[model samples]
Target: MEKKVFLLPFASVILLLHYWVTCLTLAVSLTNLSDEYALLALKAHITYDSQGILATNWSSTTSYCNWFGVSCNAHHGRLTALNLSNMGLEGTIPPQVSNLSFLASLDLSDNYFHASLPNEIGNCRQLRQLYFFNNELTGSIPQSLGNLSKLEESYLDSNHLTGDIPEEMSNLLSLKILSLFVNNLTGSIPSGIFNISSLQSISLSANDLYGNLPMDMCDRIPNLNGLYLSYNQLSGQIPTSLHNCAKLQLISLSYNEFIGSIPKGIGNLSELEVLYLGQKHLTGEIPEALFNISSLRIFDLPSNNLSGTLPSSMCCNLPSLEVISLSWNQLKGKIPSSLSHCQELRTLSLSFNQFTGSIPLGIGNLSKLEELYLGINNLTEYGSEGIVSTSDVYSNGIMLLEVFARKKPTDEMFVGDPTLKSWVESLASTVMEFVDTNLLDKEDEHFAIKENCVLCIMALALECTAESPEDRINMRDVVARLKKIRIKLLM
Candidate 1:
């Protein structure tokens, strides 16, 4: 009787264990079914599939794991990755995608996906990589994206995305590359972003973002190699701590409202290859140490308030230097002859500055030079014997005389003159009498040289002020004529 009682209890125990096992199996099946349904929802949301990749392959006849652009974990049979990049798929990301609890990566870039990102995507707690760049996606980035704490790389650039970058994004401790370039994002960059030590590259260029860079920028990002923040309305002095990013290779902060001197410490970046800091309100002398970075290829710092002379050996250590643009600044002194040392130089623009003295004679030796700009400065042509060439003086004189004639057309000095045109016509012969006596006090013996320069200026000025505009030489022709005159004078 005792043995029978024990057997009955054992049978009941076996039945109970079987019931629980069956329930667990059913739960897992339901979960997998939900994932399949989520994928189907995505296919439904798609408006157009130009390549028919999804329409033809994402059919109910096959398992969701075998569908196009879909991947599943072999062990758990759960969706893990979906990459439809460059497939010409046009769709809206559906909220049903949140059902993919095991999803780790998603890429739908280079397509026509539009509308705000579905906030439910944050439910995929395992997501590590997200790419939505080169799409027509609009509206604010969903704030729930901050919940993706495991995300390593997020590329949402080249989209029509608007609104401020979510401050909560600083929660991504594992984030590496965060590229939001070419978007309409605005507002100050979240200070916490710079604190993420794991970031390798952060490109927020071509946006309308404003405000200063955090004072501690690059303090935590030791491995940062690329930083692009151009074409923004960002103001205030650039953070001096930027030099702390020792691995920096590219730094583009041009076309902004930044107001400060270029940080001298930036020269310490040995790996820097591209440095663009133009079209701002920067002042102070160009740092001589910048020339020591032999890896520098492109150096552009134009249209600023930078002053002082360039170092005599500016290009001595730069073997890879290709472009140098420093135009429309207040920089003065002679053009450095050392610039000819950059054998790879393709472009050199130094126009509209306060630079004076004769042009460097060795400039003509640059076989790779494709573009050269030296206009609107106090520059004169170089002479073989180091004296300013006659034609060079004439070109400089013509510009000054034109300015003087325009500013004081009715000055008392021209009271008896019929017109400024008539005065210039006779400027060559009577040039000595028209000037202040103190100007010619030192050297009065060079009257003939001065007369020839004035005569050349007179003829060019008359041609420029011809009665009919159609009869006057175009500006390009005038420049060519001046170059020819300089060549003849040199010969």
Candidate 2:
């Protein structure tokens, strides 16, 4: 009787152990199957796999972790990252992607992916880095994305996305870089975006966004490094508190409808490098304090109503100065000879202003000068020989006439006068005569404006005036060729 009792208890113990082992094995197999199914769904949705990347590599017979562009955690065997950038793959993101509950990073940049991002993406609680730039994806950003509390970087630029940036984006408290440029988005920028304290870069340029910037933009964003709000319709006075961003390296707020004087406080940012405030309605003198920033490289404040002569000691404190474009302003007085001190200067544009006197002869000392535009001013010939090169004269004249001339060919002013085409053609030959005296180098004057160079400039101008807009050269190509001509002149 004692032996029977001991054997019965031993048998029961073995049975319990077997049951627990079977349950653990089944649970692990189910977890593996779930991740595998999610990946298979993604492959099924891909319409065009040009290189057969998913077709050949992602198979049910293979382990999901071994698939191309995929990584799995060693301990838990869960998907952690998937990077398929520039893969030549085309597809819509499947909702089943949300099944990757352990996914942390997903990169689909530089591809041909189209269609709206799946709202189910918000369910991936572990997602941190998301890259969807340079795709053909359309539709507004999903508001459900705000649920990604741990998201760090989000790139959605160079797409056809329209509609307002979802106000719910404020919920991404851990966000750092937010790039949404080159889209068709409209409406005022959400004020809540400025309240995200952890943000480091905000790029919302090349859109139709309008409205005033928040009054206290820099108060909440202490770590901000770049602010690119250019090429938008934003209006109103620039906030006076912009200089509070101590770490700012780039501030591009050009091509807007902003009115009033530029906030002088911006000069206080010691780390500022590039400042572009061109093509706006800003008035008043260029702040003298801006010339004192030693780190400033490009100071572009063109096409505004700014007046007053440039400070004579402009280049004294600006050690890193490279390009100075202050064209189409009402600035007066003699061109400052002090500009010759900018050793790093590559481009110096001071055209279409009311400045008088000969071009400063000292400019010839800038051996690094590539582009020098000093046309359309009440200036005389160089008083000294071999002062500066006038190789870019013809092209500069073409741009000035095409961009600013108001007298049309059909206008009454041309009733008995030369037709616009004949006028341009006649002037093309004698264009060099009106070239600013400051730009001519008497020693190598023959090389300054070559005959072929003149013909090229005239051809470009005539093509630009084509009756059909499509017949004209692409503006991008025109600008690029002009830059090339300037470079060849120096060579």
Model 1 TM: 0.75
Q: Write the per-residue lDDT of candidate 1 for residues 83-126, one digit (tens) a residue.
A: 99999888899999998999999999999999989989888889
lDDT of model 2 at residue 406? 29
lDDT of 2: 0.80
Q: Which stretches of candidate 2 lie over 4 Å from their true place?
A: 1-18, 383-385, 388-395, 401-491
lDDT of model 1 at residue 196? 88
**What lDDT does model 1 reach?**
0.80
TM-scores for all candidates: the values are 0.75, 0.79
* lDDT (CA) per prediction: 0.80, 0.80
Please, what are the lDDT tens digits per residue for candidate 2 over residues 367-433?
A: 8875566767787754343553232333254354435342223222233556555576666666554
Off by over 4 Å in 1: 1-25, 382-476, 479-491
